[model samples]
Target: MNSPELQNVPLFAFATAMEFSKVFPEDSSKAESQNQLIPLSGPFQGCFACILGVGILDFSAGLASLLFNCKQTNFKISAVISLGICGAYPDRGLSLLDVVNVSSDRVGDLGCEEQDGSHTLWDKSILGGNCCQAPAVIQKMLVALPQVVGATVNCCTGTATTAVERVKNMGCDVESMEGAACFAICQKFNIPAFQIRAVSNIASTRDKSQWKIEEALEKLHKCICG
Candidate 1:
């Protein structure tokens, strides 16, 4: 299948194949690369779709994969859209499968381990803040969606103590493995970016039964389509 035209083509980047399928299952056409698909209808109509599945859930991996895809596109990407699922903090009062427009993302594990074995946050004084801001225009467009501040890490917080510590240290309302990396890459390329996440589970505990993967994916699809 032929790729979407270079101009006005939104790069919808998914972190996994499952996530990609949720958005473009039926109309996805095989292109030059399995990771790349030409989407002809639905929310992805006339859009460039890419799956960053190799990374699984790691910040560095996300960063590398995103940059590589950007290079391969050979086009001035219109916008970088990182769309997937994330774990919401319990204190945020968000329900399962609620879509979130990530207003900002902080790299939660960017600092050193202290002598007391607690993690110390990186100094963001130079940049003036810890959180990486999302595009203002995207934020305006997503005003109807729930907005969340997210923290990205290599691993999700699985225990109560760690969860509390994470919130205290990072001041984030949700957690994901790739949001911050997506933001950074977009900033470097001077492209506007948006990280939209659907809540799949509570970050406080490691309970798969409590997760809503399908519902979250559906919400993600609907939010994007609208």
Candidate 2:
């Protein structure tokens, strides 16, 4: 019996380089070989539809390639979802292990500054504006998740000063590296896409001593499994 949820959509799951390695550790014997995509079997497999893991820089390109190749390879992919960790803004009152659902994403560092202090980027050139909105289903999922928050960023936002500046500008609940890029790709493909992030640290100052990466990852796994 075909499940309606798995009928056509392929769930694309993305994580940063470090995060990916942590979740999917490499086999020493296969170190030199390309990592192959295997069918993820579990509750998520049935509910997710299709799954693709992507890196930060290659997320958009990878999804496009996956969609194009999957057609030839006899896989039908419909939706994309990313799960990972991010920095939390102090003002949002989010703590370590809290999850965030992105409502939109923006390339915080892409725009060029003008003499008048105005900034602009590709969306401004092509669409006469700059805005990216996530799909409604994703938003609904975010609301359903336990202890979920909203996220945004200006630049990569790893450092204290940078994170503070971004929080002041965007007032987002969290910050991450690849959310905006993933949002851009999903928007282009007209795919229902969403982002889920676990807070590993406060967006204020970059303190390696205070990071709860392992704990956050554990919580994220629980969220996904639940």
Candidate 3:
């Protein structure tokens, strides 16, 4: 909940209440130390948290509303932290539960498809850039974590073909549902955006048995909320 610098308060944004849906003791240290799943607690001291719903539309609306509220209330947000679990691309040297800081994010599925079945991005003259860069200032604060490129997709990659296509299209190491939208919206608001995600599964397959949802959620909680 604390800003990357711990000097200012940030609005921690999430796509959903995935792991933080349960209420529990405010003191999660005891449970966390015992290697248990820590339940939802209060916002970390001196910060705010917002649920941005799921997908880009909900995320954009929630973030815009929050920004508008801040403007009306004269609340200054130091930055925006997009926190969640992500899937790692194959052969990316990434592992499950590895919390990584997204250095940049790009759109995963928006492009112009040609007759040859290839896709191309829009012309760059009219707000056509699909990639959003995370400010270096915020990234410096998270130097301890591995910094990887990310892609924000409306549909999560559930098959090897989809995964390969996404990586080929986006050149991303990890993929999330709301990362680029968070970054782009924050850009419009002149707020630095930071995305941190814990790897949950290989972005290649939809095999539930191979995914580590609960474990990844626990690691995600520890990474950002610990």
Strongest candidate by TM-score: 1
Once fitted onto the true fold, the runs of candidate 2 whose alpha carbons sit more than 4 angstroms away are 1-7, 16-36, 46-56, 72-74, 113-141, 146-155
lDDT string for model 2 (1-226, tens) is 2334434644535544445433433322322222233344444344232223343465556666655655566554556677788887776766788876655555545656679665444331111011133333344555665443343334455666666555554455666666665666666656666777788888776678999999887777666555
- Provide the overall lDDT of each model, using Cα atoms, as 2-decimal numbers: 0.69, 0.55, 0.68
The residue-by-residue lDDT of candidate 1 on 1-226, one tens digit each, is: 2244545556667777778778566643442234443454654456666666533344346545555665666645667678889998878778888887887887787799989989888833111111243333344546667667888877788998889998888778888877777777667766667778899999986888888999899888777664
Ranking by TM-score: 1, 3, 2
**Position 195, candidate 1: lDDT:** 76
Superposed by TM-score, candidate 2 places the C-alpha of residue 5 at a distance from the truth, in angstroms, of 12
RMSD of 2: 6.1
* Best candidate (score: lDDT): 1
Residue 65 CA displacement from its true place in model 1, Å: 6.2
- What lDDT does candidate 3 reach at residue 73? 57
> In candidate 2, what residue range of length 10 has the lowest lDDT sum?
123-132
For all predicted structures, in order, the TM-scores are 0.81, 0.70, 0.78
Q: Whose TM-score is higher: candidate 2's or candidate 3's? A: 3
